[model samples]
Target: MASHRRIRSRSTKPSPAVGFTTAALAGVTLLSGQSASAAPGEPSPSIEEVQKKVDDLYRQAGSATQEYNKAKEAATEQRREVDTLLDQAATRADRLNESRRALGTFAAAQYRTGAVAPTAALMFAESPQAYFDQTRLMDRMTDQQQQAVADYEAQRAEAAEQRAEAGERLEELSASQEALRTSKQNVQAKLAEARSLLSRLTAEEKARLEAIEREKAEEARRKAEEKARAEAERAEAERQAAQKAEAACAPETARETAQPPAQDADPGSGTADGGHAAKADKVIDFARAQIGKPYVWGATGPSSYDCSGLTQAAWKAAGVDLPRTTWDQVEVGTRVATQDLLPGDLVFFYDDISHVGIYIGEGMMIHAPKPGANVREESVYSMPIHGSVRPA
Candidate 1:
């Protein structure tokens, strides 16, 4: 696992920590503070206070949304498994019934012929093999009758096992369903609180909040450009150093180095990078098209999306299926440093990795920000960095 690295827009200035601890404290304050219904003499929470509280609520909601997505995905898989198990159990049960009918017919035929019933013979004998040996029953019975008895026993045992397995899957499905419900409730509650906080702000205060966001974005953009420049410079320096090393080598050694070594070529190697780049293009294009969509909690989008939902769908457009939720999404693809992020790379945020966005270069990303917000381009540095992944 990659460690979470903090990336600030302004390295010189002290930035407020947006870690979970601060968010949790802000949440408690929001719930306990007099901002909601301040008396005439009491003062209401300032715009910054409201902003912090609201941001925290949105972050919490995002976390819960990821949890909901995880549980939902699990439930879907569990339901499919349960369905298959039940179907197999039913099929086995049908076979068992057929075998029982065959056994019944054999018993009836034996009773009518005044021969020992198969059930009675087995009950009186110490064992089936002994009974067969003593009475020569194996020789007397038709091959079909012996096969029917074997099929009945095997089918009965198999049917019982299948039913038990199905029952266990059903229980797992129930647990997943319960988790889904709890996560859904948590997301709804957090979003509701965030809405309430925003609603308490005056029109002017809201405008100021938007302005603050814009300013933050601008700062992040500046920092991103600076970082990109530094990375480019470093790359150029490395290239120059390599060239200098080659130039300083002995003439014979340089000739040998210039001539590439012979090795077996991989047939598919040539297209690997191109294929990855093409897929990345598709992913970026898909994400760009959903820029204005609403951020619905669990939506995978034709119209709306959540953070991970949008990423998963975008990658799906490129023929790569990603796991639902930021937690799982972070685990896919090649892990890359924040400074090495490329367009279409999945950039994760926060220590818990509850949020993700598709990097579009120069530190900007297109993401579904939060509930009541539309998908839009934002600076990746707006939140603490939790590393990145290249899905392709």
Candidate 2:
């Protein structure tokens, strides 16, 4: 999530990114000349239609937010890689310089003493083996001198390789940063456009719109709960059937030993007991702690968040590194069917796969909604689901 810092208004600057113009949003078309406080007539657009339009705008903004998150993640990784390469290159260069200085001192010593060494000549010779026999150099050089020659050659090669690697990493870092900046601007523009559309509504219309949202959330919750209950019953029945089958096949003493411990249900924890259960619990804890924070387009923080920013941060807290966008996030972990979704699973939304939320069981999720909204828990079904994934 971005910080709670004030977003610079686009009032003075014209943005080509937004599809809607300010003039086009001057009035609420859904009202159809009806008073803001009164019910709409036959010609007025239904409240449902208006709500759908608003949802679409929010979805568009979410897509841009995902792009921003992806670029941010890439840039961060590139920067770290570049830094490491630079450090390695520096170390290699120092070693190369030391080797050169050592070789120089050896040469100068030979010059002062006027010692014409056969091995030194052989090292510079076109064919070392052929010259070794010609000059009888093989028996002349000590082990330390041979090792020094080898070390010097290795250091020089390492320095050259490190310099090339550093150059490549630096170039990649530059491209990543440029993409990050462009994605940030795109998210801001989409958010600005969404805010513009919502801002055109009267206070009464806004209240009514919120009411519709709540109703949908409640409806989704109900359906999710019903599905959960049915699944539990089916699981329990299967478990009993399996136990009975095992008992029938086993001897009486073995049957008693084969029984597994009974499991307890904790409603608050969304994940089932498995390999990732503990990590998932930590992720859920971090996500819950972020509730009510403001949604800032590029912010990932203790204070505010964008959608992917919040998810990335939460999973990070759990000691798992997740990619920054819903698109990439969806590609991670095992693909889970909608019917098998559990707590700690990341659920994505929309045809473009723009939005995401952390499932907290019972078909509910915690997500950082668009601008003017806060990080909060809502039904996973509140938006059209693209897919789900569980990050270990």
Candidate 3:
């Protein structure tokens, strides 16, 4: 589970590196009397449309929350059951301690050769009745110890299963919230865009229009809340899926038994003389040549470039077409551990996947950070490091 880790808001400020702007939305609006939303005497806030969207949001939200609660309850019950079982096991251990004391005393008495008043034979007995008593004691003690062991093992297994289930539920919660936020943003953006250029309509028409807007705003907010809940559920589902995928995406490793040890390997250090570093050096050099260029999200040219766009253009000069997104770019090659990072490696950031930069050796990297931001050489640590990725 994420615990108290606040969900990283994908939202950002306008200056670039990575951010969002609903400003684009204000420029878009279907305003007062500009167009008939429907037939004459028709109010666009029809019961049908509002009901449908509202119902969908409610249903999705309810289902997701319900599932989360169920999973949570199941996990709680499992935890309680495990604790109970462990307590019981501990009680049995106390019994085991008593048994050990009895056995220890019995052993010492039996082994002594002294003329003791109460000998092992006397205390434990030698007749058929006493012999039977000793045999039964051995059997009863062994059974009790075994039962405790079995109970503890079962409880441990149940506890582990419960934990996994809880984790899966939590992941669903995160994903659902993410989706909800996105959907709400979209709706809000669309609604805001509608406000501009609505002055063309008459007063009565405007009032009618305002009423519709109020109704829509309320409905949108409600749906957004619903979306939030749904997002929580979906997040968990996505996390479970990712976990499963990562598990299945195992890397191949050589297996050997009793093989001679190989020579010690060094901490890979920084850039090397040849191979990837050589090609990477050329790309870096070429990118540096374009240092005076402006940052453009999707632009790729002599004039401007977005972070990924710049990397793509540079790589193109070096004869490769790396995938565009930072997430995809990470898979371009084997991942370089943070400690072993080198020049030409690509470091990425999160939130809309808006920032990307190419490593320039040391702790330095080059990137066209964000729109209105100039292309420059910046430290990888200057911004948050989601992680560093290498091209394949």
Candidate 4:
């Protein structure tokens, strides 16, 4: 758009000439121009003079240089951002590796003990020392084991997410670099022809011009920092609110426990999660009926859905509200630990936190997988999980 302005041309040659204008139009086939000499309108400039003006404009218009410089700087910064993301991904990957080992060890232990069994009611004591083996740990898992699976899956998912973000940034940098290269070449060509004419402009003008650019860049940096700080404050406030709500819920849970044990783990059974028992009951009832449906990306309906979509649809059906995107939905609930996970929890996934799903007790979750995948129930351990929340 900036390049679309109508530039004033060496246009004197095309104007209607004044009285008795006798000028040789070099490329114009004119026999005598006695009758009508579109007399070199306003004093025809000599060809050489016109050439000089053109050369000057070409020299002064460092459009390419300006554009290329901006792109180059952006490319450099993007490289840094990409590098930072890569470093983060690598660190996550290492953690994922460690988690994998832990998961494997746990799996082997269960397998050797022949402790994992479907239709086998499994439970564990509070501590590893108080650990009890199961005939089958698969059907029902302890809160601790469920938490472990959630953590392991979360780490793996986080690593993948980070890698994907870094890869996208790399692509952006590559494209920027290519564009900058092309701009530099164009500027160089114009510079050669325009420099001779560029002398007409005073040094003060050039200096002032550069100063303006510097000011704009400074302004952009200030805006960016301001935005970052604002977002951080918002996140902190949300966290505090979640803490308050959790505190309030604790006593109520204690009261219930004094009367009857909380049966939160409902394996493959919808509407039976203990977590949902006390919260979002209406929403919980709606979501339970959608089990066994295939997932559809971004589709919102009774037939299929991705994680956030399914949650949104169910909540909508219950007259509650939620954001459309998982990232957006993350802020909608009370933050809770995996150890204290309950049914009807809305779990979120992130390295970037761009995905979300609903926890369905017993280490299982319902979600829509990424491209080419369908909506289905999967083990919380089957996918990387980050954290979860409940409607406050």
Q: Against the hidden reference, what TM-scores do the models get?
A: 0.76, 0.66, 0.33, 0.33
Q: What are the per-residue Cα lDDT tens digits for candidate 3 across 21-110?
A: 122122223223243244588655533344344333322322232233334434455566556656665665665565556556555644
lDDT of 3: 0.53
lDDT of 2 at 196: 50
Best by lDDT, which number? 1
Please report, as a residue range, the 10-residue window in candidate 3 with the lowest summed lDDT: 15-24
Model 2, residue 117: displacement in angstroms?
Answer: 15
Per lDDT, what order, best first? 1, 2, 4, 3
lDDT (Cα atoms) of all candidates against the true structure: 0.76, 0.70, 0.53, 0.55
Error of 3 at 36 (Å): 33
Q: Write the per-residue lDDT of candidate 4 for residues 212-256, one digit (tens) a residue.
A: 434443453344344434434554666788788889999897778
User: Which regions of candidate 4 are displaced past 4 Å?
Assistant: 1-51, 54-61, 115-143, 194-392
| Runs in model 3 lying further than 4 Å from the true structure | 1-273
The better-scoring model by TM-score among 2 and 4 is 2
> What is the C-alpha RMSD, rounded to one decimal, of candidate 2?
12.4
Best-performing candidate as measured by TM-score: 1
